[model samples]
Target: MELEIYQVDAFAEEVFSGNPAAVIPLYEWLSDELMQHIAEENNLSETAFFVRKGEYFELRWFTPETEVDLCGHATLASAHVIYEFLDYTDQAVVFETKSGRLFVDRDNGRYSMDFPAWGVREIQVTERVSDALGVRPDLLFMGKRDMMAVFEDEQTVRDLKPDFAKVVQLDGVCMICTAPGLDYDFVSRTFVPEEGILEDPVTGSAHCTLVPYWAARLGKDSLIAYQASRRGGVLECANLGDRVKIAGQAVTYMKGTITL
Candidate 1:
């Protein structure tokens, strides 16, 4: 079978600036093994596959090693494919995912994603956490699927060189290191060696947990954020009552055919 595939730089205004996700739109679901193989072959942080289901679409995300419950960058990339490549005219697209129904809206050349906010509880920092990050954060919070480590400043977040070998042993999807930003409201860096992504340049899902944390801490509902990875990315963020809005621009990097 020959399938159409697209590579999009999510949360970036141009190529080589944001997290790259592989998106494949399917008429029907393919075998899980095959999809996993495809994602492994693509070798991106996440590969998104979708099948049209009436007015909505069913979406799944896979890393090089495993399928995940939620992924923000890939979902944004999928919406980009639908709106820009598939000739979708609607202002927004809703995707049914393992996490739940995710909504992406397009306006003024930016895509805003409405995703569920994850609740957090304070966690005592352990030796493993310090060993993994090589820097101890002032505060630690545990979310449903990820951990938030709050540092004192942006430079600390940018200078971190994680011990991925140790980080992979932590019991979470990824370790999020964040600090107050100089230009934006906050900044972060994500490490997920177990998911085959050492550092995600831009993470939309991480912001779901971040938006709420920062909003309550900073006393604001709307804020701007930056991911301080090497490639870097910017996001316009907002914290709703139970949901968070992550807004950014995506650019098409490549379009090709996948043969199986």
Candidate 2:
């Protein structure tokens, strides 16, 4: 069997400005071992696989190391592949993932995704966290992926030099150091050494937590967010009822076929 694959950079207008995700639209569900092997070979932070199932598609995400329950940028990239390459002309596309039913809207030169709003809970910072980050946070919170650390300013968040080895043991998928941006409304940087990614270029999942937190703090429902990764990512965020809509751009870098 020949399987088609697409490599897309999600959340950036340019080809390589955002996080890269491999979108593999599969004809059928392959064995878990094979999927893992494919992802390992790809060596990307996340590889998305999807199979059409009626009106929706069953989507799954895998890292080079293991499968994950949810991935935001990869999901966005999958939507981009379906719209741009799979001949999907509709204005909207829906993907039924392990997390839940995710919907993507394509319009006005941007792609918007309605994803689950992961409610974050406030927590106290410990010596371990302080030592790992090499700095102190004014406020700390817990989310699905990582511990949310609110810094004094954008510089503090950008200046973070966390001990990745220790951060891997602290907890969650990654550590988010965020503050109000000087240019944009908010800025964040995610560190996920545990997920085999040192710094996720632009983490949409992290914004699920950041959007709500900043929305409540800033008393606004909409925001412009910037991820301070080396590659960088820009996102327009909005908080909905029990859901968060993250919008960004995706550019296809490579597309090819894989013989299976």
Candidate 3:
């Protein structure tokens, strides 16, 4: 079978400036192992697989190592591939995913994602958190698939050099260390060694926890965010009571087809 694959840099207006996700627009579902191999072959953080089902679509995410329940940047890439590549009719697309219903809106120059506000619960700081990060954090919190450590300032988040192995020990999807940003509302970085990913350039799901965490700290519903990964990404985030909207632009970096 021949499948169309597109590489889009989500949250970036220009190519090679944001998190790149591989998007595969399918008319039908493929085998699980094939999807995993395709994602591994892409060698990016995530490769999104989707099939149109009426106005909405069914979306799945895969990393090099395993299939994930949810991923933000890749989902955005799928939306891009459908609207910009396949010419799906609609400025917006709804994805019925394992994570639940996700909506993506095409804007004047960017895409806006409406994601659920993650329920973050505080937890005791394990020795691993201190060892991996090489510092003591003020507090620790764990969400459905992420671990967060509140730092003293943006510098702490920037200067962190975590032991990726220790970071993998955290019982969550990813490891996040965040603090108030001087130039933006908040600054953060994500690590997911367990998923065979060292650092995620841009994590849309991490912002779910980040939005609420910063909103409560800054006493504001809307704010700007920056991910300090090597590629780097910027986001305009807003908390809308029950949900959070993460807004950023995407660029088509590469387009091709994969034969399987």
Candidate 4:
């Protein structure tokens, strides 16, 4: 079988700067095992597979190890492929996903995605978290699938060199470290060693949790955020009551065919 594949750098103004995701569009669903093999071979943080379903698309995301419930950068990358390569002319695209209905809108060259807002609650800072991150957090919180460690400054979040082995032993699928940004409204770094991603660049989904917390803390509905990964990316964020809007630019990095 031959499948067309696109590699897109999401939340980036240029290639090699943001989170890279492999996107494959299908006419029909492939076997789950085959899709997992494809994602493992691609070896990016997340690979997105989608099938057009009338006015909307059914989308799924996989890491090298497992399928995830939600992924932000890959969804944006998939929408970029549909609009730029698949000749989609719609102003917005809807997706039926594991997380529920997702919407992506194109305005100018930027793609804005509407995602569910994940609420977080304060949690005790455990020795496991502190030892994994090599520093103690000012505050710690738990979300649905991730745990957040709030720091006092952006530099602390950026300078962190965590023990991924220890992070893998933590409570959630991902360990998020964030702080108030000097240039932007907030800055974050996400580690998902448990999901085979040691660190995620320009995580859009993590912002779902980040945006709501920061918006309430800062008393603002809209904010700018930066993911302080080695290959960093910026996000324009808005915290709605039950949802969040994440906007960013994506660029095509490579296009090719996958043979199986």
lDDT of 3 by residue, 154-213 (tens): 998889999988888778888988988999988999999999999999999899888988
lDDT of each: 0.94, 0.90, 0.89, 0.96
lDDT of 1 by residue, 1-260 (tens): 99999999999998999999999999999999999999999999999999999889999999999999999999999999999988898878999999999999999779999999988899998889999999888999999899999999999999999899999998788899999999999999999998899998899999889999999999999999999999999999999979999999999999999988
Ranking by lDDT: 4, 1, 2, 3
TM-score, candidate number 2: 0.97
Best-performing candidate as measured by lDDT: 4
| Candidate 3, superposed: residue stretches over 4 Å from native | none
Off by over 4 Å in 4: none
**At residue 105, what lDDT does model 1 achieve?**
93
Tens-place lDDT digits, model 4, residues 1-260: 89999999999999999999999999999999999999999999999999999999999999999999999999999999999998999879999999999999999889999999999999999899899999999999999889999999999999999999899998978899999999999999999999899999989999899999999999999999999999999999999989999999999999999988
Instruction: Give per-candidate clash totals.
Output: 0, 1, 1, 0
Can you write out model 2's per-residue Cα lDDT over 1-260, one digit (the tens) per residue? Answer: 88899999999899879999999998889999999999999999999999999788899999888898888899899999888888888778888887889999898658999987877898998988998899989889998766899987999888888999888988788788999999999999998888788888899888888898899999999899999988999999998958999999999999998887
Q: How large is the C-alpha RMSD of every model relative to the true structure?
A: 0.7, 1.1, 1.1, 0.6
Q: Where is model 2 more than 4 Å wrong at Cα?
A: none
Steric clash count of candidate 2: 1
- Model 3 clash pairs are 145-173
